[model samples]
Target: MPQKNPNPKHKSQNRAGLLRHLNTREVLAMLLKHGGLSRADLTRLTGISGPTITRTVQDLLDAKLVEEGEPSKALLGRPGKMIHLASSKAGVMALVIGQDACEISASGLDGKLQGNLDRFPMPRSYSEFLSLVSQKLKLAKPKNGVKLMGLGVSTPGLFNLLEHKISSCPSIPFLENQMLAKDLEANTGFETFLLQEMHALCLAESIFGESRNLSNFAVIDITHDFGLGVVSNGQQLQGHLGLAGNLGKLPIDKNGATLDAVATDDFFCKTIARLADSKIDIQGAINLFRGGAVDAMNEINLMIDHISTGVATVVNLFNPERIFIIGKLLDAHPDLFVNLLEATRRKSIKASFIGCTITRSKANSRLGAVSAVIGKLTTGKKFSLK
Candidate 1:
């Protein structure tokens, strides 16, 4: 008996099939970006063969992830049929958990919000919090054959993805050590994901906002607490245990005061109160700055100096294409970007400062979390669509 011969052509065919299957995700992502595309357009954009585009688009159509639109007129020969994501087929829920409140919203695959954002006060007890979330999930269920994809949560402090637990949340101590993702999954019978607020913001920016075309960038969230989210080579950096962007821990001064201590809204408010000899909160301080009070300006400059020091370190180390500053202060005072850029340039190297745009994040935490969930679905992650 002759020894069985392995055919090289058979192996090549198998490899080709696998590659086509993988290309399905790429096709879907492109459709999402461009809203719609013809087979020829897809072939040109993705560099895949015309036959492969037809096969991938057919597979997506079979899965109901995409749908066919009206054909386009052609100058010669047959017109082309357009393909686009089926936004009405499925929806995702986003929950943004803050210290005192939580925001929940539902969105479609096209990234358009399905309904109004629902705000709820956060309960102090972990059990109560879980109950509240469960109730909201029940209320957010899709109707008329629309599937519920999954839930994506954005919370403050350190989250350990491997353990599925929140390791630390200084503002909401009750959340520490809680298996939030697992709990949400178990309670709602749907896939759930949890991310640090800053990381979620960065992912949102990369997917739909200012950093969409950027492969490398840093998102600095300066709220009551300072946090950093670094994206390198188009991937969000999550260190061992998912604690990579804990910028609050970065020491800013010789006395070892961290960035969180020196560059937060709370810090600025307290500093203004002390310097101006008046009891004023963050909003009041913002008002004073807007009023052009010399004392308020001086305090803001001091805060910017510390913030610039931290940003300079990030620029020198990461060398990202952009640095996105996000917080109430930046939102209220758009002019701060000018001073921030000046201060950062003074502190950083000339090469580091060049081509690095610093801007404010337009998407709020709620929108960022929603975008994250939509991103997960587009990336072929597992989720419940029930």
Candidate 2:
């Protein structure tokens, strides 16, 4: 038998590592953004040569990063085979650390639900949270072919990815400087990421939501929490320490009432209850606003003023193209959004009433638990922590 050449240049890449590389990354990004397409489509989109495209795609298929679903034949040339990421392989899991509890779920790059949103009691410590994340993955008992890529935690905090520590997480005490990313990664032997909650929402929205076209826009979420997502030049404004777009903490109601202090779900509940002389949860306050309770409307109008103050600050600073408000206030006061738009016009000197559109997120909130995983996978090297 002839001695075959064992080339050092052709070292094999494990299934996951190969897809995580450049050529397939280009292909993955194209398929993710433009939808399923044939090799010809990918070559055109990436500006790569046909031969390189063929070889790279073959690598993806062999590594199972991508798979062929169908062929498109125009009859004028060779049939084009539709290629897409092999989502069938182990799905990504995300763990959302909500204010109250935690939620874990699995989803695909298409943002489709793969598993039920599994709830875990809010852990007291960052360590506890890390433990539950692994516990849930174990409980899910993911079947083979669906290799677990890794996990991401959605929490209200600042992640200093540089330091690999959560610089600050007031909402979830003890998370400060916890080095969650490193800890989780070391313990689980899988890549782990920590992301700000609303930023994650923004990433999810930017990929598939009202903010799709507005690359330089911001998504200001007002729900149980108050946060903003800044998307700039087609990427998130994850400033130093992962604390970019934290508009909620900005001073608004100088009466010591910050945006989150006065505009969050807790604020609504407390203010509504105090004003109405009755306890009203977030939904009830929303209902009360919808029912057109005169007092509720009055309070809501005042609240919108504070909201406009917060938004004005953001507008003057970032000049975002859109400011999305995800809360009952939008459902109640169309005038508030109109008023904020007007305020934004007045506050920023050069800021000419940037076309601001405020509305609820088009993507499911439930994706919060799994959305980060999708983001990490699709974000490629520029943002990939692993």
Candidate 3:
């Protein structure tokens, strides 16, 4: 016997609702990228009907998701009122769990930070971390007319995507095997999402940094560890398990040493300290290099060689249009970043190398954390009518 179809009206309604949602999303995305637009402009850009665009704009205004602005005097003839995304009317709380300190910040939907970044010492235990977060949440009330929509955490480690739990965190071992996002959401009564630091950086670049509006790019993070974040065809390249950008583990030598194993921040610091016969931090090492310390310069050069190799691999494999490098190593000398770019070009395939622009990343981890939350709220079916 054939199975009976159910609810034809419901199916039709669902289809119509989906189309409406897509139209709303298209309008919002256009406004986000281009700032304000008249209903007529949105209709022309989105290829939607003028009546539908006006209706959608009214709906968004009524929902407080968008606001109308003064008519543009630049346009010829009768100017239409401009509609802008209500980025300031809603915001998200972002927490970045780092090796040295945990940073918390808030940002509007526009990806602009609302206030100064707050930093606290890294908690030694999971319970302590939660207690600190809870304390902060109590004081994190939204301003008048602004809604705190969600929480976003940018952390360093491998994650079990299926479980929404951290699988391993070398810097903060207490976080391993913990359902951090679930716990935070349950406690705070807000939706929560976790992103690895590299992925967060990717989102940051795509949303607010140099890669904005560009679909193909890569972010190489060399701050604490070597990692890569690839955005291809306008999507972050997370592997099946949500752990795709571990570029540090790429083997670059015949002796089986990984990129990260030999070229870590700790290794660089220790190597410089040993060479100088004095205990020194990364900044001090940079000072030594500036003072023409041969040994310090040599160590920096060696690390740059490894980093360039890693970058070349990314260029060859991903063919990203731009590659942004993030780390303090780039600040060691005025010529260091330039040297890395030149070295990467020499090692990469000539055709691929010519197409990719390599530059130092300017976005910070705090921005990355904020971008993660913004991305969570704006993308896919997660964004909804009020």
User: How does each model score on TM-score?
Assistant: 0.85, 0.82, 0.88
Of 2 and 3, the candidate ahead on TM-score is: 3
Across 265-363, the per-residue lDDT of candidate 3 in tens digits comes to 666777777878888987887677678774567667888888889999999999999999887757768888888888888899999999988888887
Candidate 1 local lDDT, 1-386, one digit each (tens):
99888898999999988787679878977877777788988999999889988888888787767778899776788889988777677777888898789988887766678878889899979999999889888788777877776787888978776676788888999999988888888899877877788888887787678777789999988887788889999778888877678678787778898888889888877776676678887787777666755256666777788889888988898999999887666544677778888989998988978968887777667666766666765676522111
Model 3 Cα displacement at 145 (Å)? 2.9
lDDT of 1: 0.79
The CA lDDT of each predicted structure is 0.79, 0.68, 0.79
Clashing pairs in 3: none
**Candidate 3 global TM-score:** 0.88
Candidate 1 C-alpha error for residue 59, in Å: 3.2
Choose the strongest candidate by TM-score. 3
lDDT of 2 by residue, 129-151 (tens): 77877767667644766667667
RMSD of each: 4.0, 5.2, 3.5
Q: Which residue pairs show collisions in model 1? A: none
Candidate 2 Cα outliers beyond 4 Å, as residue runs: 1-21, 72-79, 210-215, 238-242, 274-280, 292-294, 333-336, 348-351, 355-359, 363-379, 382-386
Which candidate would rank higher by TM-score, 1 or 3?
A: 3
